[model samples]
Target: MLIPALCFVVMITAVMQTAVVPLMPDIATQLGVSPNAVGWIVTANLLTATVCTPLLGRLADRRGPRRVLLCILGVVLVGSLLCVAWDSLPVLVAGRALQGMSFALFPIGVAVLRSALGPHRLTAALGIMSGTMSVGGGAGMIAAGLLYRDGDDYRRVFWLLVVLAVIATALAWFVVPDSPGSGTSSGADFWGVVGLAVGLSALLLALAQGGTWGWVSAPTIGCVVAGALVLAVWYRHERRFDAPMVTPALLTARAVAPAHLAAFLVGIAMFVQFLAIAMFVQVAPEQAGYGFGASVLETSLLYLLPGQVVGITAAGVSGLLVRKFSADRVLMAACAVGVCGFAFVGFAHDRPWQVIVAVAVLNIFVSVAYGALPAMLVEHVAPHDTGVANGINAIARTFGSSLASALVGMLLATITIAGTDIPSERAFVAAFAIGGVTALIAGFTAAASRA
Candidate 1:
């Protein structure tokens, strides 16, 4: 029950993060905003998540995860309600920002599982929880498509999310047991929080908006430089300051650093598969010289859904593989699959079956990485540090995904079909090749790591 409950929590957060992707155009139309303005719906949520996840994770560590988890679910529920209650862009973005706080649920849930589950049970529990991320991503896509297929009212989707949030809140309340606090820290480092918030927000904003701002544009370059400087200063401050929010030692621990690096690279590979593949399958062959001409619903059901299903199964298998070999070994093997998967798709996307198989194999890589990376990091950290450590790891993954989104957008837009705005086949090939190379690098890094 506990495992299932936590899995639900994770699944819903993942769902919330991705469900709005297909509806961006619809949202833009209804809200009477430019496509650029609608991008903020996702950007706001991501920015909020990047800033708040570690902070919320710290709160969970100090206040007990169960209480904090409930609070997060409550916030998500309110966010959904707010979305339903208003049609304005500002209001919806505000709601999404609140919903973004749910990203902390993954770290906090990891902390709870560590405290509640035995060593033998923890691996499988975590794997299932991790797998739900993919499942939820697919589910969210499907749900949005299905709900909107009948009508133009996107509010219907938020209403469903509201219901799901309510159920998740109730289930979490009843099933999740309370864990004791760390009892070591009585107060937070105010300056540390401010620095992290500003630095991460600036960096994430730059990444999220880079494609729109033009990579070399003044605003993008300024943000990158400013963010880097602030974060560098923050790191130096934390290293020397007593009672820092996150210790320098923990951040750079040999056993943990590799996991974070692997997470970032794997995340980039995962989103490349998602964004590039989704676009490739949906491109009209007559216009782009390749593609299946898939509708939104068809794409979700046939391409994305199959991969997500395989990802869920692969996640469970990852736990078993960890017991037999090691997490690093599983990661290496998974990334090998990704490298092959991306290569195959790049060369053989002419057939629908090839695309389906390619997506499934790539998702296997994502699920296995998601399952194993946390185990690698959590095993090396103290129980009390689990939330913050995993929170940071989650942020690394998010940052990677954001970067991937921008890069993929740039690549796909680099070479358009003759007169149409559709991306040419060559652009997709380049994107796939980049994804494969990223996976290879990630795998090599994992193999080299001591952990």
Candidate 2:
């Protein structure tokens, strides 16, 4: 019951992150904001989550996971309500920022499962919870497409999120038991938090805005250089602090470091595939030379949802494999599968079925990789450090995904038609090729980790 409850909470967070994707155009038109401005709705959420996930994870470790979990769900509920009640662009962005905090719930929930479940059940539970992210994200996009199919009532989507969040909150409050490491004497390292927050914000801001601001522009270069210096200082500060946000020891551990690297690389491949496929499926056949020209709902149902379903099932299977075999072997196999998927899409996506098959294969492997990563990390870290460890891993993956977004944007923007906004097929192929190679590298990394 506790495991399923935690998975539910994770799924809800995943849903909230993606539910707005299909509605971005409608949201822009309704709020009288430019599409470029509306893109900040997603950016603000990603930036907020990147800054907050590790901080919240530390808090959960020091405080109780139950307490922290409830608080996060509460914030999500409030964010959903705010979106439902207000129509202004600023209000929506603010609400989305709050919603972003929900990303912390994944690491916190993983920590709770680590504490609550015995070793026999732990790996499977983590697998299910991790898989829920893909499932929920796809489900959320599908739900949003259905809800907003006829008109632009985006509030309806928020209302559904509000309801789902309330249920998750109730389940978490009732089902999750408190662990033994509740009362720590040390307070959160405030200066470390500030440093990390400032550094990551500056860095992600640069990446997120680079497409609009010109990659070599003053703001972009300044933010990147400043972010790097600030993070260097923050690393030193963390080493000196008593209760650092992320301990250097945990990060550098052999068991943990490989998993983190694999997570980041796999994340890059996963997100690049996601963005590239979404765009490819939606490209007008006449303009792109070969596409289905799918609508939002059709793309959700036909392209995204099926892969998510495969991923969910594959996660369970991967968990079983981990118990029977080894996490390193399973992770290597998963990455190999991902490489095949990306390679297939890279070379052969002229037909809709080809795209669907490639995505489903990719998602299955991605889900397996996601399941294996936490299991590997948990083996090295102390039980109490689970939240922060997983938090850092999540941060790595987020950073990779953000980088993928920037890369995809650059690729598509460069290959656009002169008179229109349509991107050439070469852009999609280039993105897929990059994704395939990244997955190949990740596979090698995972295999080498076994040594």
Candidate 3:
């Protein structure tokens, strides 16, 4: 009951995350904004999520998972309602920022599972929760695509999200038990939260806007440099602070560092494959020289949906494997699978079927990899610190996802055809190559970690 309830919460979060993706163009058109400006809808969410996740994780650690979960769900509910009630671009972006809080739910759910479930049930539960991220994302995309396919208003999608959030909130309240830790914090580290938020926002803003602002522009350089400096200071502060947002010792430990590193690398590989395949399939074959020109619905249903199903199945398989073997070996194998998937797409994405195959393979290993990662982290950390540790891991993955988005956007934008704005095949190849190589490195990194 606990696992299924948590998975439902994760699924709804995933749905909310991707539901607006298919509606981005319409959102721009209706809101009187440029497509580029509207892109911030997603960027704003990512930035806020990246910053808030770890902070929220620490709060969960001190306060309690159930309390934290309810608070986040409340935020998501408010955000969804805001989007549904208002149609303005700024309002929408603000709502999305609120919605970004949903990312924190994943780590909190992991913590809850760690506390509520027995040791024998823990591995499989984590796998399902992690796998739901991908599955829910694909499901959300499909739902949005279908809802907006007939030129319907985009507000309907937000309305649906609102309903889902409400349901999830109720389910979580009733189904998730209050474990040992609940509302017992001295007080959160206010300074640490502010520093981390400001630093991450600055850096992500620079990355997300760098192409438009010019890579070497003053704003970009200032943000990059300032963000780094602030983060450095934050690191120092955490190292010395008695009640740090993140424990310096846990971060520096050999057992934990490798898992975080591997999470970031796999995160990059995951997003690279996702964005590349989604874009590749949508390009008109005649215009791009090698694309299927699938509609949003077709792309979501035909290309991504299958991979998501495979990912869910693989999550279960990975959980079993982790129990029989070990997380380190399972993670290494998952990375190896990622390498193959990306390599195939990089070298052989000439047909729609090829793209499908590549995406399916990538999703399979991504789920497996995600399943193994938290298990590895939990093995080293104390049960009480589960939320913060997993939250840090989530932050690492978010960082990689942000980088992947920026990297893919830059590569495709710069590698456009001479007379047209369409990206060339080489752009995709480069993206896939980067993903493959990163996965390969992640595999080696995972293997190096203590089993």
Span of ten consecutive residues with least summed lDDT in model 2: 179-188
Q: How good is model 2 by TM-score?
A: 0.97
- Report clashes for each candidate as comma-separated counts: 0, 0, 0
Instruction: State the displacement of the C-alpha of residue 360, model 1, in Å, after optimal TM-score superposition.
Output: 1.0
Against the hidden true structure, what lDDT does model 3 obtain? Answer: 0.86
Worst 10 residues of 1 by lDDT: 181-190
Estimated TM-score for each candidate: 0.97, 0.97, 0.96
Model 1 lDDT per residue over 1-451, tens place: 9988888888888788778898898889888899999999899999999999988888888888898899999999999899989889999999999999988999999999999999888887777788777567777877776777634788888888898899999999899998897765735587788888999999999999988898899999999989999888888998888877877766787888888898899889988888888878888877767898888888888888878888888887887777667778888888898899999998998999999999898988888888888888777888888898999989998998898999899987877778877787899999999899999999998898853
Candidate 2: residue 422 Cα off by (Å): 1.5
Which candidate achieves the best TM-score against the true structure? Answer: 1
Clashing pairs in 2: none
* Sliding window of 10 residues with minimal summed lDDT for model 3: 180-189
Compared with the true structure, what per-residue lDDT tens digits does model 2 show for residues 1-451?
Answer: 9978888888887688778887888888888889889989888998989899988887898787888889999998998888888889889999889999988999999889988878888888888788777567677878887887656677888999899989998998899998755466435777788888999989999988888889999999999999999999998988888878778776777878898898899889988988889878988897767779899899898898889889889977877888777787888999889889988998898788999999899988888988888888887888778888888888888888889999999999888767877888888989998998888888888888888
CA deviation > 4 Å runs, candidate 1: none
Write the number of the candidate with greater TM-score, choosing between 1 and 3. Answer: 1
| Candidates' C-alpha lDDT | 0.86, 0.86, 0.86
